[model samples]
Target: MTLPAVPPISFQDIATELRLLPGEGLSFSWDNVKRLLGMSRLHPGPISLSDFLGKTRPWWGLVPVRSNDIVGTTWYSWNQSDGGLAAAVDPYFGNMPITAIMSTVSASGSDSIINFQSDPGFRNNIKAQLLDDNYNVVREVVLTYNAQAGVQWRSATLGGGDTSTCLFIATGIFTINLIKL
Candidate 1:
């Protein structure tokens, strides 16, 4: 006997797995939402911003870019023409000189303090950071790597608001970080 065809999952079902970077006025799913109420034991209350944000860790790392139209707390537009990270999958923040991308696995030691070195010749552009939930920039640090050499970048564990997912967002390009140990 022939087996019946399976229905494709709708976008809504899978959409929960996806989340908009914080601060972009986008919606997100609460994994804790269902689990909190005990699955079927009791009806869950609306996840108040306070409850959800009660105590969380800053999510640090890179996430997928939904659109070239999203312009984070940066000077350049989504379609960064000149100063932006180039198109590259293996590693983000590619060929584009000033664009940002998630940092790729490298020989460089992890846990090494991430610092942002600025190019004085061109202009002053700060690399901003944001939380994973709202993509809201919590802090702005100037890109300065004058005295300090090697790969330049400023580093910090995403704080402010909730700290559940401490993902990092950058202005120059997307950068993924990891602890060396």
Candidate 2:
């Protein structure tokens, strides 16, 4: 959605407003008050999802989740408590639209086993990659929605027993209902 055009407010305008005396009274409107307090500056305006995701750093806003749904659920491997496979089993997460991208680097040279995670409930495209120390992609796989198997987590073992630090990245959109499974 397009945001309404708001006239740029200058520092001089703010200074004049601050300088107003009690007898003179304040001329600022509610919108002006919001602008002066930097509330309006917090939003960068509406942006397309594709463009938003493409950015190195994207701005996002949180919306209230369904009361029945679990809050703060994430799909990260390191999050052993409430994340990773645990989040996948939450009934509320089923059929929930999820767009996530994450990466991690192997800590040790002997780290041949890299654990990857994705929303098992995803119904769209998912991409997983293994990259070498030089940022060169060693193994890459893109999984599309499948009716038979569906999208599941995948793992890649580095060949040649080579164990230089490697980066693993996964990006996907998942929307599956656990009740159906």
Candidate 3:
């Protein structure tokens, strides 16, 4: 036997069924209201400001741009196709020649072997470092580049079979003023 046809429901029908009158703002529980509105899949409650700002993907390296923050001073996380983890930051600090420090740790939460490399052409005066558990310097390298020709950028990578935390800290006078994570 065939089932009887069901009538299509609309906003007015839902509101009426819930006894919600005009100008009578949401007297029913939020869940009930959502259910009546066919929005049951939505989150049950309001999300925190940090979550709204993309902090939920910390492991994925999503950084939320904020007001009153210095330009190009943030390091963002990146994931490589070969199952490696990486982080990068813009090294351009405008014309004043200010020293900017950018750092990031391994996304895996454990010590892992890693390497640091700066963008090929714009690397003068860039000090890249790896720190240990006590924050002591493990390995450090200074990247040099032609001052007038290339843009400033730095990156760090976590490699295979390695079991040491990766912390990258770079201090230098960068050329550009734009933020590129």
Local distance difference test scores for all models: 0.29, 0.30, 0.31
Alpha-carbon error at 67 in model 2, in Å?
Answer: 43
| lDDT tens per residue, model 2, 1-181 | 1121343534334434333344554433333333323224333444222221111111111111111112422222222232332232222234233333222233222121112244444454434344333223355444344444343332232334333321222232221111121
lDDT of 1 by residue, 1-181 (tens): 1111244433332223223334434222443332221122133445333332222112234434322322222111222233333322211122123333222212221111233233323222234343333333443343323245444443332324322222222233343222111
Model 1 lDDT at residue 38: 19
Ranking by lDDT: 3, 2, 1
Clashing pairs in 2: 95-176, 95-177, 122-174, 122-175, 123-175
Which tens-of-lDDT digit does each residue in 21-108 have in candidate 3? 6866642335445332323324354422122221111101112211121343333222222222222322232222222223333333
Listed in order, each prediction's TM-score against the native is: 0.22, 0.22, 0.22
Q: In model 1, what lDDT does residue 163 have?
A: 24
RMSD (CA, angstroms), candidate 2: 16.2
